[model samples]
Target: MAHFRQFAFKQFGYFDFYHNLPNQLAQQDYKSFVKIVFLKAGGHVVVDFQEYQLEQDALFFINAGQYYRFDTSCIGTLLYYNRDFYCVEIHDKEVACDGILFHNVYEIPVIFMEPATSDIMQGILREIKIELAQEDSGLEEMLRILLKQLIIRATRIWKHTHQVDNEDIRQEVEFSRTFSQLVEWHYTRFHTVAEYAELLHITPKALNKRITRYSQTTPNEVIKSRIMLEAKRLLAHTPLSVKEIGYKLGYDDSSYFIRLFTKQAGASPQFFRQQYQQA
Candidate 1:
């Protein structure tokens, strides 16, 4: 069985990159993580399966469990840290940053800061680099302190820059958050949209309407996408056979599972597994 765990900062590691290459190298699928990137100097970058032309001062935050790849040619400083390092319990008690509280855990809210804002962030990054490089007593404690400060500043910047728009959008965001949490808890046993709706104490039609309004897709599509994502992960990372994988994902009929996988993934389960192996 697959289990999800929260990220903690004390167990976190840091990687700083300042390289320029031509071809892309790393394509990762993270299960649960968070990354904060400060583009000290860069031309073009790709994240979350999309390419963005980055300015020297671009700042971005990425949440866990997202699939991402990057173009190696871009030269920049990136801070790759996991959510486990943040220690959610500690953060909830100690930090009161709206951006970190609302955005960082679930979605990657990338905010483009102005020049003055960039200066403040760069200063924090410089301190973090120093802290990471030195061998000192209570290093983890220092890092956690720096991370909290960073989150506080970033959240302030985010709130100042991007104002909330509408009440409907807020409701949609809440619904999406609830829906994602439910999916995380009950995905294996409850495969249908109606199952999720019943758990949330709402009709399937209402659930579908809200999901469609928020995501531009129906509830069934969201369920299928989450299932397909897990299927791909298991197919790529594990040696389980197609039938076993299907059964693990709550499908009893292997043939029906194969058809559904094919419909959504554009390939049969066997073929998908083979392709991942080849890659």
Candidate 2:
């Protein structure tokens, strides 16, 4: 395995590049430092356990520690670099993508793109390619800025695609981003919408409204979904028993957790674990 403690980048000019990918790239999980993809062709992808089907030109953003894979061979430009290369978390206030574009579960991973937008993205990557070819002293810094520009463009699209037309745009995006972080912190300890509402210092109605505006789901639904995503990840990757997994998820009664997993995943915990492990 290659440990990218410093930096790395690549441009897959054609589907031929897929031949170089190892089988584990598709079957096992890995934490990507940062990955940005612009696909001229269409295909499907599975990030974690959630599957996404892409049928048009699209741009994708994957942050560190998220498991993902391309489902089929397609023409695209793929850029991946390590955290040591450009620490987004350290400069998060500057880029503002840590929550919204990177670790955002509320937002979709794939952004459908217009042809003109696609052309512009391609142009930026091409410029980055040129910079890579030249051994310029400031090459890394240049790539970082280009990466920032690409992320900012994608952020605009996410806001546009998910925002309600008449709302205060900044407030909506800000609230949702904050709320998502809150959910991550509190989901295990507090699972109710009202509990989260109190934490956000808002009424339950306001919380639900915010949740719906950004994620198209209620507060409780988002909370449960987050819990369910964790459950699936643990089952797929860990050796803990189903009862133990349930307990780890904060359920006192394992059966209740089993019901919740079955409801959200369309299969019992054991079945899901067996199927995924065997796959």
**Number of the top-ranking candidate, with TM-score as the measure:** 2
The alpha-carbon root-mean-square deviation between model 1 and the true structure, to one decimal in Å, is 6.5
Predictions in order: lDDT: 0.65, 0.70
For candidate 2, the 10 contiguous residues with the lowest summed lDDT are 10-19
Clashes of each: 8, 0
Best by lDDT: 2
Candidate 2 lDDT tens digits, 1-279: 221223344221111134234353554233554677676655666777667676767887777666666755555666766655555475654245454776565654677888888888888877777766656667667877887788777777766786635558677767877777788777778878898899889999988887686456777878888898888888887899999988887898998999989998899999999999899
Task: Please give the RMSD to the true structure for each candidate, in Å.
Answer: 6.5, 4.3
